[model samples]
Target: MTCRVVQWATGNIGTHALRAVVRHPDLALAGVYVYAEDKAGQDAGALCGLSPTGVTTTRDVDEIVALGADCVLYMPRLCDLDVVCRLLSSGANVVTTCGEFHHPASMAAEVRDRVVAACAEGGTSVHSTGSSPGFISEALPLVLSSTQRRLDTLTVDEFADLSYRDSPELLFDLMGFGRSSTDLAGRVAHAQAGFGPSLRLVADALGVPLDALRSHGEFATARDTTEIAAGTLRSGTVAAQRITVEGVRADRVLLRFRATWYCTTDLTPAWDVRDTGWQVTVEGDAPLDIAIRFPVPLDTIASVTPGYTANRAVNAVPVVCAAPPGIRTTVDLPQIVAALG
Candidate 1:
């Protein structure tokens, strides 16, 4: 059964997803939705560095809805609930890299209700997944917990060495990497919103619903002016940052997620920073310490990082399309088997 897939938003992650959809053996390119007017009427394949796919891209949302694609790979930078609801109400399943929908229970009641209504109306499913919260935080923890009869604590540590990342706007301006002072409130809120849901999902799966989710941010300043791929980090500027989100149960931290991102090793506090990868530590009856590393060179990491996020969403199309209509989480779906043939 060949599923018709729509490639939505040809950005970084979207570009990778578009290429994969075109090459997938069990999927056919149905339509493409682009936000930029310049991309409208362009060949989908040309946008993703592949041979022309004959499917022209359109900027109109109605045109995409009318295509009736079996699934839409919604990989936009920021999630728009209206657009997502529109797609779902039009009978197209959606598998997205957006972090918010990973756990629908974590969403506001009104927001969740709206999506539920949309799914009911069109008889379709919507799933949110990606490498970080999807794989490391939710899926991996659940697998490790299977070995334990007595579970104590599970921690997920994510490390990103952004020394070679060349996105000035993302690193310097948006993330405040090279800024004089870090915005603790903003970072904490963002971390809580982005990763708190994954922690809640894991806690719920373990049958220990959290009493509350707490988040905090810490930063280290540069000891000396350091030049990175993005730009120069002046002395006393924020050179390293760590955001931690924890799920508490019975007044104890049962699940924890920590993200450590750094552009240079030369910092006032001298924080421990590793190569781009993830570390999962499970402390229980069956203790396990696992490390997943990205061996790609730092210089070329920008070109390779998108697949980490995009591929999972691409592999999930079939599972999402086959799922019962609702907001599907990693727990709701079966193990995503990559259709690489």
Candidate 2:
């Protein structure tokens, strides 16, 4: 039973989803969704640097949805309520890479409500997952809890160098940095402000209320600004962000997340606890530290394949997609560990 798939967006994540669909025996390429007018009517394969899959990109989302795809994998730019409602009502299940699902109740309140109602009326399903808040934020901690006797704290750090990325917005747009120190200060003041959903997941996982959460910022820049290889990015500047969420009742830090981005390639990439790699630590009666490095593949296209990140997204899909039609959080869904086929 090949799952017919219509992938939205053509960015890094979207490219990975498209490739996975092409390679997966259980998935079928149905169509590609592009919001940009210039990219409309283009070949999905050519746009993503793959051989043609015969699925042309389309701006007519309704037409694509009506084509009878079993599922729509949305990896494109964020769409509004009208579009979301239409997609849900189309009777196809949905999985997105957008952060909208991080906290369906917080940032996307109206969209969530509309989706829930639409899914009910249309008898469909929808779920959203991503690398940062989705996998690192939700899945990793859950994985750590199964083996440990007592769980004290869970920390996740993402160390990525966006210097190879071709977008200037990659700095501010994705990483949430600023052009200057003052601008960055303002940004940091509200950095953790949008993290309600991620924190909610942690709280739900631990069965506790979110008591206190604080975030601080540090900035680093390269010696020079305009000569980086991917593009002429300002040198001597980077954003190092740390976010902490504490449980008041537990009197301990439940979830700690930190991400640092370097504008250039000269500096070393490392994390505080594990140093230069990814690690999950569970400290209790039986202490445990699980360390794994998500190797950044050399090829640009191959790098976006979502390796560990996909496992996180794919693992969560069954829970959310098969879940009763409604807007849900990590806590709202049944707690289950991921298993490989």
Candidate 3:
């Protein structure tokens, strides 16, 4: 069953989604939503640096949604409830890499209610997932817990070099990439966004209700000035950030999710600085520590991140299209079988 997929917001992850949609044997690139005026009217494949696909990109959301795609690969940098609702109202099931309701139950009452209303109105479904908070934080932990007799602490630590990315907002604004060392404010910038819902889903999967959930942040200063695809990092500035979210039971940390993202690999004591992509630590009667790395071309790990997120969303299109109406999580969907056949 080849699913008709629309690529939404051709930036960052969306660009990768564009390529994935056209290439997947079980998926077809029905259309695309172009945020930039220059991108509109361009062939979807050409836009993503591939052979020209017949599907042309459009800036009008209504037009793309009206194309009646079976599912939308919603990988925009930032997503909003209204935008998601608009897509759902058009009766297109949505599979997102990030932004809006990784776990709908963890969302605010009004926002969740409206999203549910839209889904009900159009009989569509929505699923949000990504590598870290989506899979590594949710699926990986649940898989490892099956071997645990007495579970203590489960941690998912992600380390990535940000110098591989070209987005200024991601490097500076979202991550505080080049900020001063004393800027604690920059450290906690992304601590509160999507981690809470992720922690909630993780706790739910483990069958352990958390007494509390907490956010923590720390920084690694740059020893010298450095330049990256985003911009320049001044000496003594924030080159790396370690942000964490933990689900605690009775004051003891049960599930801990930490992301150590840096611009340079030369930070102090360089944690998780190897060729490995991510590390998942499970501490219990049977303690386990595993490191995950993608054997991609050298110096392309950061650039491959969007592909990781993009594939997760694209591969879930058939599942999301088959799911019942309303917002769903990775916990709610079945295993994503790559439609390589």
lDDT tens per residue, model 3, 233-280: 888788877888888898899988887777886675455555537888
lDDT of 3 at 328: 85
Q: 85-113, model 1: which lDDT tens digit per residue?
A: 99999999999898869888889999999
**TM agreement with the true structure for every prediction:** 0.96, 0.77, 0.89
Rank order (by TM-score, best first): 1, 3, 2
C-alpha lDDT score of every prediction, in listed order? 0.91, 0.61, 0.80
Residue 75 shift from truth in candidate 2, angstroms = 1.6
Top lDDT hit: 1
What TM-score does prediction 1 earn?
A: 0.96
Clashes of each: 0, 8, 0
RMSD of each: 1.4, 4.5, 2.8
Q: How accurate locally is residue 120 in candidate 3, as Cα lDDT from 0 to 100?
A: 96
